[model samples]
Target: MHDPEHGDGTSLADRPHRRRAVDNQRRSAASADQVHRAMVAVRERTPTGWHAAARQHIDGALHAFEVEPVSGCIDAVACLIPPRCGFCGWRVQVGTYRIGFAVYRDGGARVASFATAGDALGAAIRAVGKEIAGTAHR
Candidate 1:
């Protein structure tokens, strides 16, 4: 007979699997929220200009990404910086390669990739400087 709650022939045997799926979704949502909050705090604290803001964003995201998760392994170092000012946005990815870095800005309209973290960071700083200059001129 069909179970009233499930409305199907499935029985208690499926309960464990369903519970696991729900738990996984909850964990994923919580993780995303944690990342978002960290990014927002970074943005709020860095309001002088895009260059300073991006620098703070990069530092904060890197710290959050380095934190160990409750389960599994972190395969990449990546973080998001929500839009702020007219000139700041970032998708910074480091440690993706054994010795490389990648970054996107202006909502991914601009992209920079590098073979070393130092080079990538320098490029990012330059990009932020340009953005700040452009905004100042406007």
Candidate 2:
């Protein structure tokens, strides 16, 4: 496949953005797995005040709960921490310095800046969502 944007002989996966989106998906999946493990722990333990509080904010998987996304963000679980993708689980933080986004991990952003955060995020979500629907990716 030929990409007009990069006429040089480079494969699609070799492109920075092509690789980056994949990396974001990989990290997002990892975050989701981590959250699922924690949720499992919460389920198996003697329920405590702290566990109950954390679960209140998480509210389980995206389908397990309903949310009214007011902004580009998924929900209002305190902006200090970018809430999980819900489908997965900072997970893709948006900044206004010329408008950009990144995948958050290890308490920092992974620097996946794009030309427009909303467009790219929404497009990626819709595209990937359609493909991964009713499966583990959802």
Highest TM-score against the true fold, candidate: 1
lDDT of 1 by residue, 1-138 (tens): 455545667567887776666665564554445445554444443334232222333322322222111222323333333323242333344443234345554467565434333333344445444434544576
* Cα-based lDDT at residue 6, candidate 1: 50
lDDT of each: 0.41, 0.35
On the 0 to 100 scale, the lDDT of residue 51 in model 1 is 23
**Candidate 2's error at 105, in angstroms?**
18
Q: In angstroms, give how far residue 60 of model 1 lies from its true place.
A: 24
Q: Encode model 2's per-residue lDDT on 73-125: one tens digit a residue.
A: 22121111223434223233322323333333445644332233232233334
Candidate no. 2 TM-score: 0.28
Q: After aligning candidate 1 to the native by TM-score, how far in Å is the CA of 37 from where it should be?
A: 2.4
Candidate 2 segments whose C-alpha is farther than 4 A from its true place:
1-14, 44-138
